[model samples]
Structure formats: C-alpha cells, structure tokens
Target chain A: MKRRTFLKLATATTMSTLAAPYVHAQEKKFAGITLRFGGWGGLYDETIQKYVAAPLEERTGLKVQITAGTQSADLVKLVANKENPPFDVYQADSAYMVEALKADLIQEVTEAEVPNIKRILPGFREYGEYGVPYSVFTYIPIYNSELVEQPLTTYTDLTRPDLEGRVALPAATFDTWSLYLLALAEENGGSISNMEPAYSLLEQAKSNILALAQSTVAMIQMFETKEASAGVISDARGHELRTKGHPIVSVYPPQGIYGATSYMNVVKNAKHPEAAFAFLDQMLSDEGMLGLPRALRLGVTTDVKLPDEIAKDLTFNTPERIALKKKVDWQKWMADRSARIERINKILRG
Target chain B: MRYDFTDYVLIVAGAVTRVAVYALLALPAALVVVLSFTSGETMDFPPAGFSMQWYQKAFESEPFMSALWTSTYVAVIVAIAALVIGFAAAFAINRFDFPGKGLLQALAFSPLIVPAVVLGIGLLYLFAWMNLIQTMFPLFAGHLVLAIPYVVRTVLASLTLHNRVLEEAAMNLRASPLRVVRRITLPLILPGLLSAAIFAFVTSFGNVTVSVFLTYGGNVTLPVQLFTYLDHSYNPLVAAVSSIMIFVTLAVILTIERLIGAETLS
Candidate 1:
C-alpha cells in the first residue's frame, strides 16, 4: 500500500512539472510582438508610451515603436506616396480618418482583427470603423474662478464684452474653422448640417477673440499667466492643468461640445499585421480601457469604471453630453471650403 | 549762428535717436533670444518662473543629444567640403576666361534661389531613386548643395576686391605658381574663406524645413528635433535648449576669433 501511494505521488509531481513550460510559453507569447504605430501631436504618445507601451512590452512579449510626428501635413504627404509608407500604423482623429479612408491611405479593419471591439462603448464603436477609440479629446472652456463670480458654462458667454479680449481660441487653421462653424450653427438653432451661418458666426467671434493659439496647451499657459481670463481647450489638458493647482474649471458648454477622438488604425500593409492586431485587441479589452484614464491621464471611457476625480472631468461616459456631441463633415469642409477657410483666416489676421 | 552749445546738444540728441531706432530694429532678434530663454514649460511672454530644467531635459533626452552631435559633425564637414569645392569653382571662374562663364555662375548660385522645400523634395526623390534613403550621405550631399552658393559667392567677392596683381608680382620674382598662391593669393582670400565657412556652418545648423522631410526615424538634425518638440508641447525646455544653443554659438564665435582674428585677412 505504501509503495503504491509513493508511485501515485511521483506521477502527480511529474504531471505538474510538465505543465509549467506550457504556461511559461503562453506568457512569453504575449511579450514577443512589436507594434509600430504613429499619431498626431506627441502628447498622447508620451503618455501612452509611459503607461501602455512599456508595461505592455514587459507583460506581453509585444514591443511597440510609437511614432508621434504624423501631423496633418505629414499624413497628406505620406498618403500621397502610395508605394512605400514610413509607418506601420497611425492615429487619426475622427475628421482626418475620413480623408485617409477616402484617399485609400488605410485599410478597413473588422472586429475579427480587434476582438476587444465588443468591450468598447456602444456609441464609440457605432461612430466609426477607421480607428479604435483611444481618447476622446475636445475643446472644453476653462474660466478663472477668482475673476468670474458666476460660473461660465456655455460657448455664447464668450461674447460677453467683459470677456471679449480675454478669450483665447485655437488658431489651428482646420480646428478653429470647424469650431467656429459649429458654434455659429449651435447659436443659430441650426444643426451641424449647415455651415453658412457657421461662417457668419465665426466672423463675428473673430472680432471678439483676443488671440488664437496653435495648441490648447498654449491657451492653458496663457490662462495660467493671467493673460487671458478664459479659453477653449482639450478636456484631458484641462484636467491636467487643474491638477497642477491652477484655479481653472472646465465647462462642457450647454449648447454642446465637439469631440476629436484619436483612434488607433493599423497601417494598411503592415509587415506584421497579425501580431499588430493581437496587441491592439489587448489594448481594447476591459482591462485595457480601464488602464487608459490612469495611464493616459485623460478622460476614461463611459462604460469602463474610472477613478471618481477622472470621471468628473471626463465627458466620454455621460449619456446626455454624448448625445449632444456633433461630428464634422471634414470631407465637405476640406473640399468645398478649405480655400474659403483660408480667405477667412487671412481676413481675421488682417 | 556760430557753433553754439545748443546746436551740439541737438546733434547728440539726433545721434541718440538714431541709436534708439537701431536698437528698435534689433529688438525682434533680441525678442527671439529672450523668448528662447523664457523659463516656462509652455511659451508666454513673461515666464511664470525661471529654470534651466529644460536645458537639462533637452540634453538628457537621447534623440536631441544625438541630433545635436550629428548636426555639429555634418556642419563642420559640409563647411570644409563646400569651401574646397567652392574655392576651386570660384578660382576657375575668376582666373580664366571660359565659354558659358555667366551660365556657370548662374548654375552655381541656382541652389540659393531654389526654395528649400522644393530643394528638399527634389533631393528626397533623387536620393530615393539612388537608394540612398535613410542615410546621412544624402544629408551631407543636400547640405553641401546648400553651402556651395554661399561659399562661391564669398570667394568670388574676395577675388573681385583683392589685388590680384600682387600675386603676379610674386610670380615675376621667380616664385613658383604654387608658392605665389600659398604666400600671396590665399592669404588675401583667407578672410573670405573664413566668412564663407562660418556662413556654411550657420546655414547647415539652422536648417529645419529641408531637414524635416529628409530625417527618418533613426537620423535627425538639431533644428528638426527642436521643431518636433515645439510642435508637441511648448515648454521651457525648448527655451533652455535654445539658450544653450545661443551660448554654444557665442563660444564658437569666440573660438573662431581666437583662431582667426576679427580683422579680415585681406
């Protein structure tokens, strides 16, 4: 009886030892893939690299080469050169994705390549297929609490004479033009469908704006200097500033807000498209989305639970706010009126 | 009336006014330097605080340091290469009467008139065709093209202004042509050569628009790095880096002065 018991124990130990390598191999597979990705301005890249790239590389054998210099002009230039592309994947905000898709600069990716698509909030998934929603960036108005006794919460309040010269708007030729059009449409009780009134309203607002900035970070810095009393800025950046102890309050204006989402789209002809998609799928998983707000230091996804402080500042999850958020027909804006936009910009500068 | 104290005072006042106007004219450059030093992460006229942290940050970053080192070597090489090639070309143009002299001069100066962006694009396409993409050699070739015009123009100017008959006199004294060139002709043109070298180096160092499209993932120039950094975020780090660049520039000027005195050799 004792001999039989000893043999059985030895066999169980052998079985356990044999399974260990299989488990080890599985863990190692996750870490072995390298992803080459590109994006617009590099702030998010820096944040994502620190939070996502490094950890993901260590945890899964997946390494990532994060490229961040792919601005609008670079995108256009890269797309124009069809035979060879410099990047394996790129991040395009909602508007540019349309341009990229239309240009055939990128290929359409289905849910199969991105299994975590199921985990994404319904609204975000339904919005577009060009990219996986990484962060919902928008121009949120921030006001100095010390100067303004009553809180300012809407875009229309910017026209108040008291706030006239103190207002800062993004001077980005594309974003500013779009925002002006949207605000004008909102003010005139019209939908984002029409841009004629948008143009007229933009002209009116052009008169009141004290200065225009190439970046929202610049606008925030201007606000911090007490040079400007109020400005429109990205929600993520606004939250970052407020955390640094600036007496700034972000308001998602009552008329509605516009959202510019950065999405992760695999390069059309990536060298390792399969491995790249696998890593991307991990990025979209429940665990992945949860990690975003903390790792990215931005607003969290609506469906995913985030820290209370982050949730308060983020607009992704709010049902009412999401309903009011409008999409820009960037193609129409780019095609029909880019020249007109340039003319208006010149007039404003003049 | 006869020279009075009031008239002298008025003349001094007028001189002071002119100096002020020049100062005002210099103000824009002064502002760029000051803004380059302003100590805030993001750019604002008056800094929230002052710190050399950005300089420290810039040097700490691997890419910026590598880019700086790359540009320094590239500029030095380009200046020397351009000077040698330009001097030969300039001498051939000035010393001999050749057919198509005007056309050659125009061709040599052509790169200067070409917009840097167009030149950059042309070079990009040409280099890609030659399978030189993502290589420092292309940058060297492109920068050499940029530097040639400056060097040629300077050397040509010196040839025009200096006394060429002195070299002829040396030759008449039984000095060999090589000896005459070494002792008389070269000395007369040394200042122009030095000026051209400095201009070449400056042109290579400050270039961004041309370098941007050319730089791939692994290779980058200083101005290209700075452009990327500024584009992403406006931070005092950029100012800090700019300030350090200004100091380095001053140091370079001083070193050059110590080697070749401020007075023109001619």
Candidate 2:
C-alpha cells in the first residue's frame, strides 16, 4: 500500500511539472516584464496600438507602451547607453534599416527567438533575420474615375497636355527616382540601368507635373482636394478609398508599378528585448494581421491569405510587379541628390 | 491747397495707384482664403466650387483641435513669462550700471541671430541631458529665447522715451524707490509691455521649425500639425483654418488699435 501511494505521488508530480511549462507559456510573460515600442507615423501604428497592445497587455499582464514618429537617428543616438534602450522595439523603413545595420544599432533575431518565422512568405525571408516585413504596397497609378475610363499606363501619359497640370506625382526624389528610371528604360526598350536618360525624363516630368506630394496621404489630397485629376499612390490606399465610397481608383497599368515594403526591426540593445520579440512575433503571426485590413485599409502581411476583395485588387505575388521594382541602391540613388532635389523644388515653387 | 482740373486728375490717379498697390498686396492672401472655402476636387488656382466643408472637417478633427489648444496655451504662458523675465532684464540693463550688461544683452538676443535648426539641436541636447524631453518646459524655454528680443526692444524703447527727471522728482518727494517704480515706471511702460506680449504671443503661435523639432506626437503644436498636414495633403481645409486664424489675428489687432489708438501705441 505504501509503495503504491508513493508511485502515485511521483506520477502526479511528473504530470504537474509537464503542465507547468504549458501554463507558463500560456501566461505571455516574457522575462517577467512589459514592452516599449516605437513606429513610423500614421494608420499602421494606430492599428497596432488598438488591437495588439491592449489585448497583449490584458492577456500577459505585460504592458506595452507605443511611441510613434521616433526616427532612426533617435535610436542611433541611444545605442551608446547600452544599459537602457529608450525604446524596446521600433520600426525602421528599409533605407533606414540599411543605415541602422551599418551603425550596429539593431540586433539580429534567429528562428529560435521568433518561431513564427515559417509563417512569413519566402519573399519576405530576406528581411526576417534582423527585421520583419510588416506591410507592403505598390506605387501604382491612382486616377479619378470621373476623369478617365482607361488606366494611365506609362510615365509618358503624365506629359499629355490634357493631363498637364492635372497629374501629380510623389514629390520626393526617393519615391520618384525609380519611376523616372523606369520611364527612361521604357523610352529606350526596357531597363533603367543608367542615370543620364533618367535625369532628362525627370526634368521633363518636373516641368509637366502640377504638384508633388511626399506621402500617399498627400497624393490622396491631390485628388480629394481637386489639386490634381490623378496621382501616383500605393495600390492599397487606392483600393481602400474606393471601398470607402471615394471616387478614386487604383490602376495597375500594363507597365508594372514600383513595389515598396515597410519593416519592423529590433533595436540592437533594447532593454526589453523579450517583450520586443513577443510583440514582433505577434505582429508576424495570423493573430496580429487580423486588425490591419479593417483599421489601416492596407493589404495584409505575407502570412495573411489575402481576403477575396484584397486579392483581386492587390498584386502581392505577381511576377511582373516583382520584376519592375528597381533594387533600391540608396547610395547611388540618393547621391548628390539633396541639392538637385532642392533646385528642382525651387523651380516647382515658381 | 486750391483746386484745379489738373489737381483733380492727379488726385484720381493717386487714388487709383493706391488701390492697385493695395490690391497687389491683398491678392495672395485673398487667393489662399478663397482656396480654403473650395470644395473643388483638385488643389488648383481656380477652385471648381465654394464650400465650407473643409472648415467643418477641421473643426471635427481631434488632432487639429488639440494641437490648436496646445499651441495657444503654450504661446500664452511663454508670452507672459518672457515679458516678465525679459522686461526685468531689459530694465536692469537700461536703468542700472552693471558688470557685463552689454554681454547679457547680447546673450538675451543671441537666439534671434542663430539659425532655428541650430537652436533646435542645442535645446534638444540640453533638454535630453536634463531628462526634460516631451515636457512643456523645454518648449516654453525655447520660445522665451525667441521672444525675449521683442520684449527687450519694446521695454528699452519705452525706457528711452521716459525722462530720468520723473523718477528724480518722485525721489525728491521722499517716496520709496519701489513706490516710485510702481507708480511712475510700470504705468509708463504698461503699453509697451502689452505690445511686447502681443508680438511674443504671435511669434510663438505661428512658429514651425523650433516647434517641429521639439514636438512629440501627443504634444503636436498647431503649426507643426498644419505643416504635417500640408506636407501630406493640401486642400481648402487647411486654407479655411488659416483664413479663420488670419481673421482672428486681424480682429485682435483692430481691438488693440481701437483701445490704444495707432499713433499713441506707436
């Protein structure tokens, strides 16, 4: 009887030990602390705070504080004080990520740290080691449906006298340079490998364009505010406004549009890295993407199966769309361009 | 001043010329204000239609309202503090013989000469080191740097106008120094203080560069908010709000003018 009783106690203890990790895993406590995060400006940050931060804090007893518009320069400045990272995690655009990597301002995360790695699309794996691609958009042509029945297909369309002073383009050189290159390539068969022809086309486009907006929101204003008949904007935003009963429609012209992605990376010496990783893991998973489509009106992340309407409008995996994206050589592209952009800006101001 | 036919033609011609010059100056502001009311689909020179929808939208937007309030609050506080501190400093420099008075005057107005971006960077570092980022204190301090010059100039001008004999007369009557200053000096400078405060308030209110670097998202001031919005979207909504601001400013100026009368205030 004594032997049997002892064996029962041993089995019960073993069962409790096994169940403990499962219960602990369910608790969402990462190193027994909350997370601090930072992100770029706009709707994406809003969605994360609304759906992800609040729910995670409730479930895990780990509070999450979000700071938006915290730039990469802020992080680079903070890295010297290794003991405390002002932000436990922050989002960096690809160009900013390149700079961060060079400065050793962000740490790398292996698959072990983020088990949701397999959920991301293969195309996104390139960015997953040090950063994870959170959102994507194509810089496609957006036009007023009332103004044009047919899509504005090529860069040359912008120069049409009828469309002159009505067609708006992204004003930023970073945003428009690739389009300029593509315009040059189209002028000479198909490839923007050189710079001289691109400049000529850009100068021409500059002369023809009505206005340039820095952000999609700005471009949207060109149409909504009646500043321009049409503009170049992310396809996702175009579809979003259309869904909202706006007159704007995103057009995927015969020639492909430039594709861009926004990413979130871990700061090198983030104080609450576990919290950061937990938030990152959540954002990468199917659970996190649930809130974005409705709140932000952007296409879902890679793991998300595009909703029927979204899939129809978005060119997420289209081969042609992928091919047209010029590899962003920020060094070459942004080189000696600040002054040039300013000079062009001055003429545009006139 | 005898009237003649040539004189009548000259008078008419002068009036027309005056009208034309005023029209030239008014045209830009009028155009911007007109754009504010437009419901046109594009931000073009000649708007398609006139509508107050943008103004309604701006009023409804929480961010814009909050930013407007924050800017107003900060401007008022900064104006009052700057006037007090700056008037005192200016009075001391103008009235008393003190060591390094010239240096103090230069330092007080130095921010006016410095580039706004440089001032932003310096203040950012100073505030960060002191662990005061995201607070109103730094913003107030920065605005003071911009505002003190106006106060100094106005107060110094006021001091230059009043004779030393008034104070000497009060002293001769056996009145205390503090009593003489309160009765004689302060009353004489009240108008100048009021003028300086108004200038400081407007300067702080309309500021962008210094406010932009200093602002965090939650604490976005009005000009920064407008600038960001303008960067992303230019429409009649921003124009409408701007027009309202211009009207309000004009109203304030008119009120001041009526109270003091232009010649006396000057």
Per candidate, native contacts kept equal 0.13, 0.00
> For chain B alone, what TM-score does every candidate structure achieve against the true structure?
0.87, 0.86
**For model 2, what is the C-alpha lDDT against the true structure?**
0.67
Each candidate's interface RMSD, rounded to one decimal?
A: 3.9, 5.2
Query: What residue pairs are clashing in model 2?
Result: A218-B232, A225-B41, A226-B41, A226-B42, A226-B43, A227-B42, A227-B43
**What is each predicted model's overall lDDT from 0 to 1?**
0.69, 0.67
lDDT of 1 by residue, A1-350 (tens): 69999999999999989999888777766555556665332344555665666666666677776543545634644553455655667677777777777777776667877776766665564236667776666776778887766787776676666676787777646552246456656667765556556556556666668787765556667777877877777776676667657788878766777767667777676666776676667566555555557643554433666767656667655678777665566565556556655755765876
TM-score of each: 0.82, 0.75
Instruction: Report how far residue B135 has shifted in candidate 2, in Å.
Output: 5.2
Docking class of 2: incorrect
Q: What is the C-alpha RMSD of each candidate to the true structure, in Å?
A: 4.4, 5.9
DockQ of the two-chain complex in candidate 1? 0.27
User: Candidate 2, residues B1-266: lDDT per residue as tens digits?
Assistant: 79999999999999999999999999978987888777874455687788888788878866667777888888889889988888888889888998999999998888889998678667866777777764677778888888889888888888888787888999999999999889989887778877888888887888877765566425667776676555324446777767766675566567777887787677
All candidates: TM-score of chain A: 0.83, 0.80
Whose TM-score is greatest here?
1
DockQ of 2: 0.14
